[model samples]
Target: MKHYLRPEGSPPVNGYSHAVAFSGTSVAVSGQVPVDAEGRIVGEGDPEGQLRQVFVNLRTALAAAGAGMADIAKLTVFLTDLADLGAFRKVRDEFIDVERPPACSLVQVVGLVHPAFRVEIEALAVLPVESVQPG
Candidate 1:
């Protein structure tokens, strides 16, 4: 994957790239919330804890598709409050490569599917052709 961190005319980025280029089997991961496998909310009103669970869910979902966090090319994040941006970035860095971050878009929404959910993240990844297995 190629990360266009600072394109010629693009503005400086904080923790994401302007764009990403990759050739492989495309994998689309649905939006993930801060719920565990049992559907129980992991964090109540804490942004850090909520973001952590979201990342964990993303990892599990990616693995099921034969991909990992490093395979991700882009991310779409939704937060009920923009104030959680700091916690979001802190937790996100734990899962994604900081040096070659994926293209990302963050949106502040009024609320998520569940009122208890503070954040939701969706990812787009590319798995190398050789990594794809016959099913």
Candidate 2:
């Protein structure tokens, strides 16, 4: 994938690319909340901890689809509070490639599926054509 961190005439970006260009088998992961496999919320009233769990869920979903964090081309992040943006970036850098980050859109929503949830993330990834096999 080609990451345009700052396209011509575009303003600077903090931790995401302005655009990403890629061609392959698309994988769409559903919005992942801060829940464990057993359906228990991982973090209670902690933004950073909740964000970590969300990333874990995202990783699991991506792996199930034969993709990894590096293959992600886009991300849609939802946060209940904008104040947690710092924590979000810190946790996000742990999962994604900081040098070649994916295109991202962040929204500060009034609430999520659960009031206890502080963060949710969905991803769009592309598996290289060569990596895909006929089924």
Candidate 3:
């Protein structure tokens, strides 16, 4: 079963939920962009800056679902340029501290929502039983 998350005072949704709550032992978060805590785009013209922002964004999303980087099972990264991949990997390690990191995949894409944006990361996590809290 799946439940949508829409906290009070949050903006209206067009056709998608900010996240979905599931009944399994783990929770999974969808792709998160470089949008900041206030929902504004970050690192407008820089790939490295944008990559860091993506991590921040993912952390925020994971927290909302009662999960964290340690619980992540996989991360799929889409990039506009292959040359910028090293920077993205460096930034990713900074946020994820587990010795055995989650599975990861990188893909080169022509473009994203905005041309200035060079990266986007989507994550899937397994919510440990200990991490789940009763609402």
Candidate 4:
């Protein structure tokens, strides 16, 4: 279970909540870059493509931890260019539920460890014990 918060007087958040609360096993995922399982770089210069791949990578990591995007309570996005914020959000809506969007922070970075990468995102997800049942 999760609860989202939006302060009474704070300015409206366009795509995210002010805070989120959850109880259960929490999983912290590493910042995901646009790379395939083979470690091959993807979407080298396209922010939209890169952002999409980043989400794909995030989903894979979450699945490994017995969670999914719907279980995420918070997210931190790192971008080399803020100009891509619109595109980033567009692709995000395709994966995350806008009605119960998680608390998020997007930061502009000078660079990532990889020159071809333009976006990276890390997420925190809370999973109920039942969700961890063995397959």
User: What TM-score, computed on C-alpha atoms, does each candidate reach?
Assistant: 0.98, 0.98, 0.75, 0.93
lDDT of 2 by residue, 23-59 (tens): 9999999999999999999989999899999999999
Off by over 4 Å in 4: 133-135
Report lDDT (CA) for all predictions: 0.96, 0.95, 0.73, 0.89
Question: 2 or 3: which has the higher lDDT?
Answer: 2
lDDT of 1 by residue, 1-135 (tens): 999999999998989999999998999999999999998999899999999999999999999999999999999999999999999999999999999999999999999999999999999999998888988
Location of the lowest summed lDDT over 10 successive residues in candidate 4:
1-10
Query: Would you list the clashing residue pairs of candidate 1?
Result: none
> How many residue pairs clash per model?
0, 0, 1, 0
Q: What is the lDDT of residue 131 in candidate 4?
A: 70
TM-score of 4: 0.93
TM-score of 2: 0.98
What RMSD, rounded to one decimal, does every model reach? 0.7, 0.7, 12.3, 1.7
Off by over 4 Å in 2: none
Off by over 4 Å in 3: 1-24
Clashing pairs in 2: none
lDDT of 4 by residue, 1-135 (tens): 554556788778878988888788889999999998999888888888888899999999999988999999999999999999998999999999998999999999999999888899999999987776665
